[model samples]
Target chain A: MRCWERPLIEIIRLSVNGDSHEIGVPSHYTLLETLRYVLGLTGSKQGCDKGDCGACTVLLDGLPTLSCILPVQEAIGRQVTTIEGLADPDGPHALQDALDLTGGAQCGFCTPGILMSAAALLNVNSSPTRQEIREALSGNLCRCTGYTKIYEAVELAARALREQRPPAEVLRS
Target chain B: MLRLHPYEYHRPRELEAALELLKEHAGDVMPIAGGTDLVPNMKHRLFAPGHLVALKGLPELHGIVERQGEIVLGAAESLSSLADHHLVRSHLPSLARAAGAIAHPMIRNQATLGGNICLDTRCTYYNQTFFWREALGFCLKKDGDVCHVVRGGTRCVAAHSADTPPILMALGAKVDTASPEGVRSVELDEFFIADGIWNTQRKPDEIVTRLRVPLPSPGLRTSYQKLRERRSVDFPLLSLALAVGLDGDDRVESIALVVAALGAKPRRIGGLETLAKGERLHDELIEEIARQAYRQSNPLDNIIVDIEWRRAMVPVFVRRAIREALARP
Candidate 1:
């Protein structure tokens, strides 16, 4: 559509996962929509379509935020980190590998958001207690695995990140 | 996928420009801070403003400062920041607990104090999707004439579910608001009205700037008890904020017990000072006060929880809250 065709269109420069992209989206589009639909970073699932669920979680300036409710324009100048940002050229991120090892993702629908929340927690607290891990991931609801394995995965990931080694080594130890 | 109706998004660097936009847009504009509540409400079609004035990170509304025996909390400060701020944790522990207790951690990262204070009243019927509400033929809180919660009732009885207002009111905080008419400070107790359609005294053109919470007295003991189904991410089924100050002789010097999530306004239990003042906060006195609170609180059917059960929990929570306050160092 042309500019005059839709006056409500806003062209926002988004910084997601260390990459900047200038995209034009409807002014009311949420960051979740802008990411999944516009940017094609669908790793962040949309669960409740509101702030109640953490499925649409992303890191806005490194803090876990509900992107489903966050306006895309609000994210224009901030560092937006999604699940895609977690892995590197070498392999899957420690959290991902740990999840696989612990059978954290049964349905795998809530994994991305869980990873984002756990990542935000581990970024600051390299050694978080089990209670702290539970508190950090409280927003995420995983009905499939009953959250025991998810907690185990975050613990393993935290250990690996602290030891500066692969999660497999940390798990074996 | 629920989506917000298209609207103009405005980011004003200064408070003046924001006020200008609010004035120009009048009823068509809303100042969005966290977008935690408003966005979901918009998705539910509760509100569809033509413009949203972004208020997050505005320098005029962003800091927690202690001045003149009061702690001034910037309205736009995120709840997590408030919960973690050393000054807040040390000086206003009840407020910290209330702020931290709201929603889950991620929501706390984005939700703001001003937003929580100005949170929209909620009801099971009113908070649902348009289809759900429409199927029920709507209610008085929004787009309908009849109230489903109270048959033949004319007033909207939607509950005020915010976690911070009860504590703030019990603490005697002041909410500062700015508009085209200049700034005004109102006691947090007077900031809410009983009408659930819009419970706040805030006008369309006004923006909450900061909250001034008087520093607690040295002998003041405070506690907050929230009754919710889950430990996190759930609005309170019932919440009580208790603050009691003891004299050197262990007699009650002052007391404020505010109960919320029952109605449009957080009701401060009357006759508390008369019953508590100059009296020892013993088991007998606590039990009497709890009975009085139970009698005073009238839990409506607005909330999805069973009204009788919720009513029963009032006294239980009151006793627990009082005990918690007394136990506080």
Candidate 2:
């Protein structure tokens, strides 16, 4: 295709996790689309498409953001980490493992978003109670199973990290 | 899912530049604050502005400060910042309580106090996505001809949806707006218009720059109470914010009581002052005040939850808000 074939909307190159893209996006394309489509990081699901459903959740500069509605241009100078970035390619995030062990995930459309939200929550609060977990995960929804397992998973992850509290081993090495 | 249609985006550092843009562009431009309300509404296709004048990068519009015995909160200060600011927590505790109760933690981090103050008066018939409205036919607030919420209605019946306005009104806040007409301060009570189509007293070109609040006396007490379906991210079904103080012998010195989600703008049931004069804060007095609140309020069935439940609870919310105000010793 020729350069003139597509509308030349200005874009700031975005680096999500380790990958980078010089994609041409319509001014309205959100960070969620850039991560899921241009970058092929499927871990960031499109749940609500509005900010309400945390299924599109990711960390913008280490704080959880609903990527679905976050303008891509707003991500111009920010760091974005998706759920895929949370774990080593070899395995799942300890939170994810804890989720499985605790049966935290049921219908998994929300799993990726919930995992990222929990990862951010767990990083900030090493000793979150069920109330904190509930509040933190309010943006994300799990309809099939109630919130019991999810709350338990957060507690387990907190304990795991507290005992050893290793710096998250997933992204760099 | 709500999507932002393509629009021109301009970031101007100065307030005058922003107001100039609004003037030149007029109705075509929408001012972007925290996007707490505007962004979501935009996604829902409730609005389709050709330009978005973003205020986030503006240096002049981002602080919470106290000066000359008054607290001036920047129009763009995030709710989280206001909720956490010590001056706000001290002088305007009811306002602080209301701000903290809005939406949720993340929203509070991003929703601006001014953004909530200027929300389009919402009607249940009016707040839905474009597609949802298409299915049901549109109402008076946006695209359609008839007011779905009020049959045979000549004007829109959208409820005042902002959570903070009632609180700010009760705190005796004033808005400072800058337009090509120059700057002016309007008492928060006057800032709202009862007519639903144009709910705000502000001209389209004016930008709310700062809100000023007088310092609270040590004896002044305040409280805020809201009824919403969920603890997070839902607009208020019925809300009340009240501030009260007593004279030398604990009689009602002055009172500021405001209600939201019921009408076009927060209405002051200042009638409570007459009811409270010379009377000690008592269950019977509170009951009268609550009854007066229900009597004064006229809620319509255009939003989520029942209109009857909302009307019935007006007194409850009023009593609770007044009780909270009394509890603020």
Candidate 3:
């Protein structure tokens, strides 16, 4: 270990979901804690608190990352997109609607993180194969659905995004 | 919810400042690149550093550049980026594969190459909650003295579980490190020591800043194969990395077979050079190589699976890795 004397608390600014937030937190607080406890955004779940479970997955600079292990200071100036940021002015994103339609979320504990991961995937590749979707969501675990419905939901959402059709309209068909 | 032990955190924007801080706080501060490994260990009370020097956003330790005939990888480069980098994919696909296969996608996003290379050895006895370890007598790696893995043993036998070191060693990569003293480069093969307690040769104040992989010559082939409990998120029970260079006549010219996760350090088996060099690779020769790897592997009962079974799987994984590397055009 190196020797240094630094203040325990630091004021860090973050750009989260298009909103800039300035918060004073201890350096030890992870981004997950800042988002859930301090900033009052509880969309991301803390399943493992380690990097094992993807329940705390969030998009940092458009890339899905685990916020549990990321220090708040590391995310100071980065763009953080949580599950709460997934919805638009209209309603839930297409992926959320697809999950609702397909009953992809059973316990819903891991839903937010899975949604963030899949959203990041769709944001990059609007139309992805089933295998690609599975690969993209490999980090996210769904113990309840057995991952069948989640895979179907991602496929449905991909089609909805590709066809520029509302998720409700796609589900109706 | 497991909480980290509180400590002063210093985010140094400059590499020089980070090194200086490390030099000043040589015995009290730990450098953190991605907290994927350190934070979890902190939760387990494996370490309680007084201060943490954050290495994030240090321009010196961030980038993958192809210089001259080598791929210069910044130690701070995330595993995700390294896996997706075109240079790594084209020139060192085995490294890319190993990078992608580590932990999971989110972990790969936060974990860096240097962090993985410097990842702490693991044992079931050592990686538990503080209360859990307290209830049971602690092992030699941490608080208690007796080694739980090797009963009555004098030292720690925690297995090295990182997925990159063996592959890097197979590629004959070198790492450049920085300290207040100066910067020095060491071959990856010489970086790791055999002891589980004092795993690497890195000093307290030194920080691994970059890894340089020499560009493969023509006819060079490499592959990395890892066997774990699950495909999603588990450390490798056994991993084999094979790098073979075939002569124009299709005979093995140069070869390196490194088996990891079975011991404290990844070791390159010497039997391959003795048996397969300058010879056309055949099923019998491959079998002999696998047998040698199996004999060299020394798995302990400290990991998830049965020790005997993990030991037996060494040859199987090595055969597969060798076949895969040879099959690639």
Candidate 4:
């Protein structure tokens, strides 16, 4: 099929991490590109630049999605949560701290995506079994850590969240 | 960074407007629900549609409703939502399992049922970056002249990778489509064509609106089994879907056995009804059914696994699926 000529760029208005932003981008631009390039939220890595890798994973309307394949126009008016959004001004999110304490992030390339996936899981089920954690993070491939530490980290985070304790405090005790 | 070629993207709030846009653009336009498949293909330059009619925002294609003894699934329903839907899990667990089994959780969260059903057939020779495909001199499915899977063959042999169609077909599902002319419903079995290049009968101007699955009768049991390389995101090397109904006497009254990912379209094994009719669930009968499935399957060397191995696994999967379906209460 031939290309249809249209406006060179379109303005997209969406809420990312509770902040609303209006950005001009190509209609075909993926959410990953808009997040990393335009908005400067580079936590979501562009691993495969395809749906195969979940390194560009982020939460769209509270569900984990592969931002690399998601068109930016589709995210219009939707709530997008990236790894950077996961942290508070006070400190890192419990999951991030748990990953750090558990050595879940060796290379740290896949950690952001894994954190989002795990965070989505915890949103629904605060206490997920190891199998559930494995299934939830199956999309995020961590080549360096071998997933054992990552699974432990998610479990640790879940426990921290359930007990209403900071991950750092839990790890210390 | 792999990027999509510049194209006009149109997101219509209403389904009617979307259909009109499709009709106006015709051959130049492609309706994209989830870009999980199409965006990657666009990156590979396999398809460069001038206009993409985004179906994501249309509220019409976004709900799972139960009406008149049928489950109506909106075409744009995300795979993750469908898998987790209570009705799907309680009634059609096989479909939920199939949807959950697709790609990964992240992809499932974005990919939709309509997109998965209309997923492009895949081959080792066809799915590649533009540079890689150019270096190898594209195959029949793309810009090439010959079929690489079968040397000297005239037709493309890419395998269908969707996990839902076979199960949907076996469960007697129908797909609804809309165009400028009107809206029509097609049985899932009749929707798929047995060619890799143009696999579905869906017209360019038509958009799949919804999938209607007739509620299976009591005593009707179903199962879906897929064999893929990995436990995560890999597409099925071979898949078997079984739907069987038992009579009051516990004899098989109706049976549908479908094998997918072995060819361009999911093939329903012929003579299954006759062979399984009035037959009791026994070792010999199951073995005979599995053998029939093995005989009916035609696997090519286009996908990842060994051709012969895939062919041989058909019976094994069929047997397992049959047992699983029969075992389910």
Candidate 5:
């Protein structure tokens, strides 16, 4: 048996969605597992636990990262945002409401990851072109193949956010 | 969900400390920059290192600068930043394109240049889950000894599926590394050897610091073309990087074509200067160069793609790459 094969535990600090928490996690745990299992933040879905599917996407220090591949220790001192962080006490995020209203999420298994990816994009480019939206969401895989509606939802959400109106109002417009 | 093997994680604040950790653990510890490659491999049981030394945030390994006629790219710089940087975009657009074309947006945000260049050789047989490989009896790349890609063969033939190394090789780049012993630099051309188990010249204890790409000549035009099933997230089925320097009169002064994703090391097509020098990129000359690329590339069934289909794409992609380069202003 090798020395490194032995399991070890360490206490680490993580900042997620404007909150800070100290938790003990196994040294080998990925951010996705730490979120879903240890911290009970299961909004970051784990799909293709490797780097293939973007279902494990999270916003790390304002950048969308594949949490399944990210070692939890690396998240120290960085802000981690999952799908749960997208909305406040008010309601679902504009993107989420837009996705629901547009019927963009068929299975909902891939929604959390896709929302995180889209949030990262909408944060930077509030008014993204269709091509830019497609490029940004390319990492995420939605098996339902409802990309047309998903793209439409993103377009609709962008207009609502830019106009400072609800996605429902923007959808009607 | 695939689980990572039990291990210890070390995050060193200094490069010296990181090197010391790597030296102390030696073969037991693996340096993890992006974790975009190593993490998945670990989950797949391709690697089970006892310890991982994080190199993502070392100050010494982060930055991009134009230094003395070269573009110095910090090994830890993310692919997203590198692809979007003005210096890389204006000076080495092909490299920028290649960097942008890697994986996808979320991955580019985390993956680094060093990780991409040092990416592991991949194969359908080797990249599978542990049970999948065990049911078939493992191949030469991992626990088993027999070579499944080339049955009865003694060597491992996993494909080098990186998008940027071939471009860096064509651009005459140099790799810089640091260790407890000190720092060392090597030409990117000699950095890779013909072995799929571990292909790079980097020692186990050394950490890649940065890459220095000599600035392109005024008339030099370079382009990269990738053949993947999808536009995002898929590794290259076939990738080609072409660079041609033309005299003021539009006559070829020098040319280089490097094709990858076929073998352990990216194959640089030879005799290109002999055939292309002092000639215009006419239909005949282009066809001849494409033929040279076709003759040199022999893609196997390492990837699930058809071997013959991948081989047929060598010339087609080469011609398209040349046309793309020629079209660039």
Candidate 6:
């Protein structure tokens, strides 16, 4: 019998960000493999094979789960995320635009995880503090991006979100 | 890292069927609740059960209830859920605090309270993958004979390094377990076996169902303290959970001090209670009790972080946990 022929490969149907990834992942394969190999959604980088590195960060059921360590079988029916899910490529988020304009993408290997972390924060609180940004981005490491510009980018995003706030009186009245 | 040898997965919706699977497969079958702990271990090939019994489908294993006066927490309740439970916060506040302190928010969302309680026994020597263990000719906990922790110790010296046990014990909780034989209640304190090779005396067939903590009476106060190398995701080098009460005059009524991540079980320090009862807590008295605790703790080279630092922090955390519990004006 072949390695995957033992009635193996549990059919995993996942809703990744807004897209769907229905793949025949092997029993031993990780969710990272599903993203990188199967569907070619390679935004979730595989930095640390173990759970230590946050590079494989993805939103499983809207929480930042390290996909490299998380089993692919575990993602069945759960929502997954990647940098690809942050925004439409043409319509970049203030966070993404800020990162790009502020040169937060030096080497870019770790930018995806950093963006995912920041995007999760901006999803909840549009206007976050400087300390809050630091706390939120603590898990994602960027060796090339020395975090000064990244911090500035978070500040810029917070400002943009606050300035772009909807008129409360218009909605209410 | 080693690979997880593939095992057939079975998801049974009911508890009885899961137990039946356990009976059929015996040692070869492993039941997974949260998969926060087991899946990582499987990938490491630390203990590869031949059959993987997925317990996520069993609804009976999950839920939180306030029955009568006691808080009944199902085994599948996640750490994040426990941290967020209003009843748990009001009744067993230290448990909530401990649950929140574990790992990080992401891990807490997936790592259940029962998973933390039933976390596989750990040690620096024993936690490595199968191949690493094989290189060392195995240790006492798994496939080998001698304990590397104690050099020639006859038993496995793997520590019961769970953060939740000490807090649960301090809260006066009891657990209900179901088996093919019948159901039985084990006091949270008595549930942990002192032996490491066979860490828990619980029968393999018995599955922990619900943990119940009695309602908090008036004058109850609680606090939890953890000492680790860094703040996030690292297991405690030394942890203490303190829960106590004061009479009308603010005299000590009842006291519990439990230490975790130090030994094979969450060892209750009966000596600390001697200093607590009948006296009004003062800084001098607190310091005296902590000193006694520090001397009593015997840490080995079996865990990460300095054993000396772990031993040193015992009194500090004990003092903090107690002080926080009593926090007088």
Instruction: List chain B TM-scores, each candidate.
Output: 0.99, 0.95, 0.98, 0.98, 0.99, 0.95
DockQ leaderboard ranking? 5, 4, 1, 3, 6, 2
| Tens-place lDDT digits, model 3, residues B1-329 | 88877787888889899989998777888999998999999988898888889886799999999999899999999999999999999899999999999988888888999999899998889889889998888888888998878879987788889999998999899999998899999999999998888689998788899999999988998989898888878999888898999989989989998988988889888867868889988999888888998888888887979888888888888778878888888
Candidate 4 chain B weakest lDDT stretch, 10 residues:
B148-157
- Best candidate (score: TM-score): 5
Writing each residue's lDDT as its tens digit, candidate 5 over B1-329 gives 89999898989999989999999988788999999999999999988889899998799999899999999999999999999999999999999999999999989999999999899999999999999999988999999988888979888899999999999999999999998899999998899999988999988888899999998999999999999999999999999999899999999998989999999999999999999899999999999999999999988889998989899999999889889899999
- The CA lDDT of each predicted structure is 0.92, 0.78, 0.88, 0.90, 0.93, 0.77
- Give the least accurate 10-residue stretch of model 6 chain B, judged by summed lDDT: B1-10
Task: State which candidate, 2 or 3, has the greater TM-score.
Answer: 3
Indicate the docking level reached by candidate 2.
Answer: acceptable
Interface RMSD values for all candidates: 3.4, 5.1, 3.4, 2.2, 1.3, 3.8
lDDT of 4 by residue, A15-92 (tens): 999999988987778899999989888989999897887899899999999898888888888899999899999988
Among all candidates shown, the one with the greatest lDDT: 5
Candidate 2's TM-score on the B chain? 0.95
- Better candidate by DockQ, 1 or 4: 4
TM-score of the second chain of model 6 compared to its true counterpart: 0.95
- Candidate 3 docks at the CAPRI level of medium
- Candidate 2's C-alpha runs over 4 A off are A1-8, A18-21, A88-91, A165-173
- Residue-level lDDT tens digits of model 6 in B202-295: 7766778888888877887788998876576677788888878778888888887888788888888777566778988888878887887777
How well docked is model 6, in DockQ terms?
0.30
**Could you tell me how far off, in angstroms, the CA of residue B267 lies in candidate 6 after the best superposition?**
0.9
Q: Is the docking of candidate 1 incorrect, acceptable, medium or high quality?
A: medium
| Candidate 4 residue-wise lDDT, B57-91, digit = tens | 88988899889999999999999899999999988
Candidate 1 residue-wise lDDT, A1-173, digit = tens: 32223548788899999999999998889999999999999999989998887999999999999999999988988999999998998899999999999999999899999999999999999999999999999999987845999999999998898889999998787
**Among these predicted structures, which one has the highest DockQ?**
5
Q: Which stretches of candidate 6 lie over 4 Å from their true place?
A: A1-7, A102-107, A134-152, A165-173
Off by over 4 Å in 5: A1-6
Q: Rank the candidates by lDDT, best first.
A: 5, 1, 4, 3, 2, 6
TM-score of each: 0.98, 0.91, 0.97, 0.97, 0.98, 0.90
Candidate 3 chain B lowest-lDDT run of ten: B2-11
Please, what are the lDDT tens digits per residue for candidate 2 over residues B1-329?
Answer: 45577776667878878988988788688788767577768877887777778787677888888899899999899887898899898778777878888776656766787787788777767667788888888877778888877788988778887777887887788999888899999998998988888798888777888899988877677878888888877778989888887777877878777878888888888566677766788888888888888888888887867889988988888777777666656
